[model samples]
Target: MRIRRAGADDAGALALAGAATFLETFAGILHGRDIVEHCRKQHAPQVYADWLDDAGAALWLAETAEGAAPVGYAVIAPPKLPLHDLSEDDLELKRIYLLSRFHGGGVGRELMEQAVAEARVRGARRLLLGVYAGNTRALAFYARNGFEHVGERRFQVGGNTYGDAILALDLRR
Candidate 1:
């Protein structure tokens, strides 16, 4: 697989991969209707397009080596979480997802490395992210990467609200 910077033209692929991964990850854990509604809006191509247009945002897409089909993506942007201690030099790992089939193959790690490198290049001191509080696997993954739980917030999905754990990794480490 190859991970590359994503542009506005990649909105569709990003949307597809984003929606697919979201659904795949939350299908059994979250309410089906909530999953559908959440993906519909959160993973829309227009959303990605808008992010692409933002000067402070960056996205990377992971694609298969053979057919170049998008399999995963990661996005980093100016802090949007509800952290009161956020600083101008901080960034958020707004999203990072990969198809389940590609798990454990190092693609996720590559995506994460790309995000961290980009954040450092942009002079960010800390990188934050929010994850479903109940997602043990994801939480463990983040912990392994040196992220520590720092806060919590309510995440809205469709008409439902869920708890989210905020994690932060100090780039100065």
Candidate 2:
């Protein structure tokens, strides 16, 4: 697979792959209306385009081959929320999703390596991500990557509220 930093030109692919991977990952937890609405707003091409256009936000896309469709992507940026107790220099891993077919194939490890490297380059003191409390698989993945559950937060998708566990990995020794 080819993994590279995505530019604004990749917005459409990112949006499409993001929606597909999101559905594959979260379909079990969300109701039909909520999932559809959440994906509509959060995975839109325009949203990704905006992120690509932003100087502070970054994304990495993974393709199966040259000029092929994207199978996965990851995003990292400064925190959008002023969550209590996190460092001012904390970086948030807003997303890391791949097609289920690619699981156990090292795609996620590569993505985390790049994302964490970038976060360190940006001088972040820690890396943070909010995962749905129900997603034990994701929690295990993050734990293996040295992230620990630091707290809890509530996330609202459509009319439903879900509990999310905030995980963090300290970048310092």
Candidate 3:
């Protein structure tokens, strides 16, 4: 697969991919209404376009073949809330998703590696991310990829309180 920086022109495809991936990945874990609402809000085309236009952020997409469409993408930016504990300098992995068909096909790993490499290039000493406690598979994936649990925070979704574990991987080490 080939990975490359995504631009504003890719916003629509990115939003579609994000929504599809979220729905596929969180089907049973998140209430259908909640997932739909979250996807609508988080994957809006305008938001994706704005993010892609932002110079402070880095977005990468992985395509399965030469001149093919992207099947997965990752977004990284300086730490933002609801993660108040992380220092301002810490790079946060805001989103990482792959088309369900590409799961376990190494696309996720390559996207993650690209994000980490970008963080290092930007002089970030550590990478931080938050994973819902309910997402055991994702938690395990992060742990296996070198992230360590650093803290926890509570997030309310669909009127239910869920623990979000904070993970950090020190790139300086």
Candidate 4:
């Protein structure tokens, strides 16, 4: 797979990829319109486009060997809402999604590597991410990547409330 930084032109493609991966991954857990409604707000092309315009935001896309559409993506930026009192050197891994076919094939790992490296390059001391508390797979993935549970937060998707574990990795380490 190949990875690259995204620009404004990639907004639509990124939105589709984000929505697809999110729906596919959460289909079993989230039911019906809940998933659609969440994706509508979170994965809209305008959302990504606006972020692309932000100097503080960075986005990366991963493509398969076939070089078709992107299969996964990652975003790192200053936290929209700091979980607590964040210093200037903290960045949040806003989102990372991969199609099911790419799971366990190192796609996610590559994305993580790029995101963490970018975070450090931008002089961030800590990298924080929020993952569904019940998502054992993602929690394990973050743990393997040297992230530790720092706290928990309530994540609302549509009308549903989900517990999300806040994980953090110290870049200085």
Candidate 5:
């Protein structure tokens, strides 16, 4: 697979992937109707377009082969709290999503590895992310990949309460 920086032209595909993966991954963890509703609002093409232009953001797309379309993506940025308490120069993994078909295929790990490398290049000494408590698969993935639980908080999604676990990986190590 090849990884590359995403351009504004990729907004639509990125949004679609985001919504699809969010829905598929959260199926049982969140109410079906709520998941659909949230994805619709949050994954709009314009939102992705704006994200593409944001100076603080960096998005990477994973493609299967030369000239192949993006099948997965990861976004790392300055952080959106209550997931993090950003210190200057720290990097936050805002979101990481892979098409369900790409799960367990090493794409997610590759994306994260790239993110850490980029963060280091940008002079960040740490990386942070938040995983919903119910997403054991993601939590396990983070744990296996060197992140440690740092804290927890409550998150309200579609008016329903859920636990959010804060995880951090010190890149300086």
Candidate 6:
């Protein structure tokens, strides 16, 4: 696998990866219509293009070595989590997804490491993210990476609102 910075031209690949991974991850846990609608809006190529145009946002794409097929991606942007203390010094891991087949291969960890490095390079003091409260696997992954649950949030997917755990990793370490 190769992980590299994603440019504006990579929006389509990012959208595909985002939607596929989102579906694979939430198909059974979330309502089908909610998942479909959420992916349609959140994973659109134009949404990614807009993010790519933001100077404060950074994205990375992971692809296969064989045919360069996009398999995973990560995005970090200005903090949007519901934290009262948030400021320009913080960043949020807006998204991170990997094909289930790539789960145990360290690709997710690599993507996380890249996000941390990029956030630090941008002078961010903290990195925050919100994940479904029921996703034990993802929660464990974040814990292993030193992220701590700092808050709670209500995340909307289509017409459903679900509980989420807001996690933060101190970048000063």
Candidate 1 worst ten-residue window by lDDT: 26-35
Worst 10 residues of 5 by lDDT: 79-88
Predictions ranked by lDDT, top down? Answer: 6, 1, 2, 4, 3, 5
RMSD of each: 0.7, 1.2, 1.9, 1.2, 1.9, 0.6
Per-candidate TM-scores read: 0.98, 0.96, 0.91, 0.95, 0.91, 0.98
The worst-scoring run of ten residues by lDDT in candidate 4 lies at 79-88
lDDT score, candidate 6:
0.96
lDDT of 1 by residue, 105-162 (tens): 9999999999999999999999999999999999998998999999999999888899
Candidate 5 error regions (>4 Å) = 83-85
Report the lDDT tens digits of candidate 4 across residue range 1-173. 88889988999989999999989888989765888999999999999998899999999988866856788899988875436767788999999999988899888999999999999899999999888898898898999999999888888887898888988999998
Clashing residue pairs in all predictions, respectively, total 0, 0, 0, 0, 0, 0
> 28 in model 5: Cα distance from truth in Å?
2.3
lDDT of each: 0.96, 0.89, 0.83, 0.89, 0.83, 0.96
lDDT of 3 by residue, 1-173 (tens): 77788987989878887888878888898788888777788888888898888888899877778666768889998776455566756898988988878778788898999999999999888899888877888898898889998888886555466688889989998
Which has the better lDDT: candidate 2, or candidate 4? 2
- Could you tell me which 10 consecutive residues in candidate 3 have the lowest summed lDDT? 80-89
lDDT of 2 by residue, 1-173 (tens): 98899987999999999999888888867887888888899999998998898877889999998668899999998775447877669989999998989889999999999999999999999999998999888899999999987888899886799899988889885
Kindly list the per-residue Cα lDDT of model 5 for residues 20-80, writing each as its tens digit.
8888888887988778777888888787788799988899888779666667888888866
Q: How close is candidate 5 to the true structure, as a TM-score?
A: 0.91
TM-score of 1: 0.98
Model 4 misses residue 48 by how many Å?
0.7
